[model samples]
Target: MVTGDLLMAARAGDGESFRALVEPHRRELHVHCYRMLGSVQDAEDMVQETLMAAWRGFDGYAGRASVRSWLYRIATNRCLNALRDGARRPRAGATFGVTPPPPTRLVEPNSLQPYPDSLLDGVPDIAPGPEARVERREAISLAFVTATQSLPPRQRAVLVLRDVLGFRAAEVAEMLDTTEESVTSALKRARSRMPRERPARARGTEELALAAAFADAMERGDVPAMVALLTDDAWLTMPPAPQEYQGRQVIGEFMRVVAFRDGARRYRLIATSANGQPAFAAYGFDRGDPVGHPRGVLVLTIEGDRISVITRFENSAMSCFGLPGTLEGSDHRDGV
Candidate 1:
């Protein structure tokens, strides 16, 4: 059935029609919420709220705006409301056992979480609008999302609508219930404040090879070899925690003193992908258990043949990627 027919049937209180109408946009809307809120859990919550609101207000939907825009309007406002209410903010950094090197600087409080590449599978790509400058991949990169964290909630919404998701200025204004001029101004400020870092150009074969090398070095407990895979100015950051390590020397020291403190401890890296980058679910064996226990998820940002950034999340993030909390020998080869 055409969308109009679906809409009419949906408005008549046919639940199946409503589901059919909205289901196609589910993944993309979740992504939109993720971009706005930065946490998969929070994004999921807001998407729920958006869909519920859409359902409740289906009778009132004027049909003038496209369904996608209407849903975005609802989702964006819900995120803004959460931000304004102070109900959503970065969680505190996960506590680490080891005492190690001093950080270069404390990064801003970021509740940023990785989005599973698997969830991105069926999300239909929308071409960038005329004024949109941010590419699709960069929009979803950890660096870009982290930079957006520093923005005011409204500006973040505007930037994501206008630049990231490629909504037009007028359309964004309508979504936010503001003037087009306001949207334009907010986009300008947001663009100016965003950190200029871009996603590394490495992709496909080069990315796989580099990630495999890092994994091999990690499994062998070779900190130096792992460090060799990093670029000279590489960064290592743990989200939710402000600590950021820069440069191969500093990062290598951090790994030696903290990550490998148990003396060449072998790790199991279950390969995965997050935020369109190669990631692994790292595990360590317990004294009695043959299977490895969940440690954390490590996401790598590659530039050319070397890793430019390494961001590790707490073990709690494993569930977000559909990773099992514990891994048996047979589970080793399966991707999460």
Candidate 2:
């Protein structure tokens, strides 16, 4: 049925019609929320709220705007509300008094989560079109999301709507209930504050090769070889822990002391992708357990041939990447 027919049926309380109308936009809307909140869990919550709000208010959704725009309007405002409530601020870093390494600014910690590629399968390519300066994939990069945290909630919304999603200034203004001039000004400021350069490209045979080698080095307990894969100004950070290790020397030292301390049995890495970048799930073997358990998810930021940043999340996020809660058997080659 046409969207108009779906809308009419949806307004009359046809649940099936409502689902059909909204399902196509689900993944993209979820991604929109993720960009706004910088937390997958939070984004998931916001998407639920947006959908609920949309369903309840479907009758009142005037046809002045497309259904997609109307949905974005609701989602954007929900994110703004969450931001204004200060309920989604970055958490404090690790309690240890270790100073952040040089060249790596330990910004206030936030509830950053990795986005699995598996979940992105049906997400429409809402990337900016030919006229847009930003690449569609780069807009979803972890680097871009992290940089966006620095923007005020409204400005962040403006930049994402206008630049990232390729929405017109007038349409964004309508969504935000602001003037087009205001959106333009806010977007300009947001652009200035965001990171100037996109991080190393996440897709390519070379990138895959680099990620494979990194995973191989870790799996084989080759610390030196692993360290060689990093740039001199590399960074290592575990969020909600606040401790950021910068520089290859500092990162290597910490890896030796903590990550690889108990020989190669400490952890095993399975290659994966998160936030559109190379990532891995680090499974650590318990003292006597036959199998290693999920420890944490590590995402690497590459620059040229070397990795510049390594961000690790607590083990609680294993399921977000569609990983098994426990590695049942010795065979870890499932997802690699």
Candidate 3:
């Protein structure tokens, strides 16, 4: 059951044991890749690359480092090289099942494209056990990921390895090919640059209750109640579509025209978190059976008592969010 045994078995040509050695780390490694690449599909691909490299280069191992550390080492370097390669740009093909209705008239002064649940929420919530889940959830929200996205590559790696995953500075330094002193300095800077957490905290578990109410209102096409939940001058956006809408009426109208609000019911949410924001996978059902993860992702920006903005990720990049044609098939489903 030990990783060393699996590695030894793998070296002796037991591919299944080698895969078993690395399976537990795969999801978390994708998370690490997401942090480094900032694209879900890219992260998934990077994880695959890292694993394949590990397999092919098994002979190079001198057992100089722990297996966990060694895998991270491969992943971190792969992601860094991905960033340097420039051939990969963040794609916009992401889609959302739920989108904020756009305005027919003049739009609000401020707006941002809403990333879908699959895209914004694709973070793999890979806590090792029940005891660690809550702590892990708090650390992987959208706000946190957004902040990390701004960090320099090395510092980003340091913060993730040190603070998020609980690695010591020595371990982090070894992973990044640097000294512990440098790792310490990077963490300090990363912490300082982190954004001030917003005043409107995600309702956490209360999201299920809130989602139920919202679903009923949406099914009946109750514009007023839906508007009531949103902030004044709320912004709505869908990515890869390149359209923006602001304010309550415009948002309402867009919803009517675009969303298939005809006789919908039995809406179920996948119950996830993103960017530290509360979110859901948002499955749809007419009578009972599920139809889609169409609103592939939702990231809400709250400003006290009201939902200030909502972004619907449109699966812009074909590969980045790990989305195939539909959620039933491929898109990486986690953290949202």
Candidate 4:
């Protein structure tokens, strides 16, 4: 049936019609929530809440806005409410292991999680309006998402709605129940606070090659080779761990002292993509084991020919990317 017909039937309490009307929008709405909340699990929870609210309040959805816009309106507010109420805060004091070194600055355990590129397939790429300043891929990058986490909740909402999603200021204002002037002001501030430098060469050949080299270095425990692939001012961050190491030298130390500490342990990297960047499912094998146990996921941020950031998420996230819990063939005769 046509959307209008489905909308009519849905409003009349046809569950099947309502499901049909909402199914296509679910993935994009989840992406929007992920951008706002930063955690895959929290984003998913908000999407569920948004849909429930939409279903319960279907009668209030005036036809003035397109269904997508209507749903976005609901989803945005739900995230904003979640932020304000502190319903979801960063998981605190979650450490991976012993501290590596003094960080560049004091950083809390970041709750931010990587979004699998697989989830992004078929999601619409174009901004809905002309005001979008961030490109589709840039908006979903780990760097961009982490930057957004530093903004005030409202400014985050405003910037994402007006600049990332390209909702008009008026539309954003309506979504947040504020004035267009408020949205404009918040967006201006948010844009100014955002990192001026966007990461480069996403999913391109250069980025792929860099990711491959890093993976190789990691497997062989080649500290210099891994450090060489990083930008001089590169950063290595493991979320749920407060430490963040910066610069090639410091990152190299952290790798030698911490990551490659057990000389007999070997690593295998299974290539994947996350947040529009190159990533891997890292598996580690003990001294004599042929099976590699899931360790964590390493996501790389590339700029020009060098990698600028390496963010490692815990292994609990592997299933989200369709990665296996264990891998065989530890011989490493043919490198990944």
C-alpha lDDT score of every prediction, in listed order: 0.85, 0.81, 0.61, 0.84
Whole-model lDDT for model 1 versus the true structure?
A: 0.85
Error of 3 at 53 (Å): 0.7
Give stretches of model 3 more than 4 Å off: 1-4, 92-134, 198-205, 232-296, 301-309, 315-336
Looking at model 4, the pairs that clash are none
- Candidate 4 structure quality by residue, lDDT tens digits, 1-336: 998899899999898998898878899999999989898888889889998998999977778888888999999888988889987766664554655667776686667889999889967654458988888878899989999998998899888888887888888887888999888889889989999966556456767777888888888889999999989899898887777889999988877767766476778898888998899989888778888898888999898898989998988788888887788878662335
TM-score of each: 0.94, 0.91, 0.67, 0.94
lDDT of 4: 0.84
Candidate 1 regions exceeding 4 Å error are 197-200, 286-289, 329-336
Q: Output the lDDT of residue 308, model 3.
A: 67
Q: Considering lDDT, where higher is better, how would the candidates rank from best to worst?
A: 1, 4, 2, 3
Summarize candidate 1's per-residue lDDT along 1-336 as a digit string, tens digits.
988899999999989999998888889999989988888999999989999999999999999898888999999999999989988767788667778799988977677888989988978876867877888888888778878878999999999888877788889989999999998899889989987766457878878988998998887778899999999999999988889999999999898777876563446888999888899999876445568778889999888789999999888789998877776762244443
Tens digits of per-residue lDDT, candidate 3, 55-154, equal 9987676788867778989999888887778656544443434554544343222212222344434444444332221246445555566567767777
Q: Evaluate model 1: give its TM-score.
A: 0.94
Descending-TM-score candidate ranking: 4, 1, 2, 3
Error of 2 at 319 (Å): 1.5
